[model samples]
Target: MAIDRQTVNRVAFLARLKIDDDKIEATEEEFNKILNWVEQLNEVNTDEVEPLSAVNDLPLICREDNVTEGSQADKILANAPMAEYGYFVVPKVVE
Candidate 1:
């Protein structure tokens, strides 16, 4: 559909945008150009084209989700001022 001055005014009001009176003509022309481009795109045949989540067909690089207890307890506790039973020793917050 072609964009008109009234359509531009209505759209601006609905979108809570302020288009200067002088720029309204330029804005309407830009909108018309975009619509014409979209109309041209609609004429292209894509009946056999498959819809894709991504343009490329590269496989997702993923690591195996292995469930296990962490093995870095010693390395992590080495930086702590004190550690006990494979846990960091922090001051008790509750009385």
Candidate 2:
């Protein structure tokens, strides 16, 4: 599809841009060129190309999931101003 002056004006309005009267033609031409270039992408053959998230195919390192973060209550509670129940003590926020 070709871009017209109305399309250029609409795009400029939506994008919050102020295009002068003398520049509208230039802006429309540039927009048409961009649209034409994008239309050329449709001619490329991607039938055999597989969709991938990344270009690299690195194997992820798998590890056994286990609970190993414990036995540090005293070490962690040392930084709290008040720790009666092994947790950070903060001012009551509710009325």
Candidate 3:
């Protein structure tokens, strides 16, 4: 399908792109090429193909969800600019 200059302009507007007047012709040509390539893909037969969720067939490796170390509250709050009662203190935003 041949994409027109107006269609290219509308597409640019929808996509929030600023295409110069001189670039409209080039943009339209590129858009039409893309559309033609997509149209060509329509001719491919995928009747026997199965849809796959992931490209890799390997199972995902997971680690045990257990704490290896004890609590270090002082160490954690050491870098804080302002900490109050074992928690980070920030400027209140609500009036």
lDDT (C-alpha, whole model) for all candidates: 0.92, 0.90, 0.90
lDDT of 1 at 66: 86
Pick the TM-score winner.
2
lDDT of 3 by residue, 1-95 (tens): 88888898898899999999999999888887888888987798889889878999999999899988769989999999999999989899698
* Each candidate structure's count of clashing pairs: 0, 0, 0
Model 2 C-alpha RMSD vs. true structure (Å) is 11.7
Model 3 lDDT, residue 90, Cα: 89
Per residue, candidate 2 scores C-alpha lDDT tens digits across 3-69 of 9999999999999999999999999999989999899978989899887787889998887898868
**RMSD of every prediction:** 13.6, 11.7, 8.5
Q: Mind sharing the TM-score for model 2?
A: 0.48
Query: What's the true lDDT of residue 18 in model 1?
Result: 99
| Model 1 TM-score relative to the real fold | 0.46
Off by over 4 Å in 1: 45-95
Higher-ranked by lDDT: 1 or 3: 1
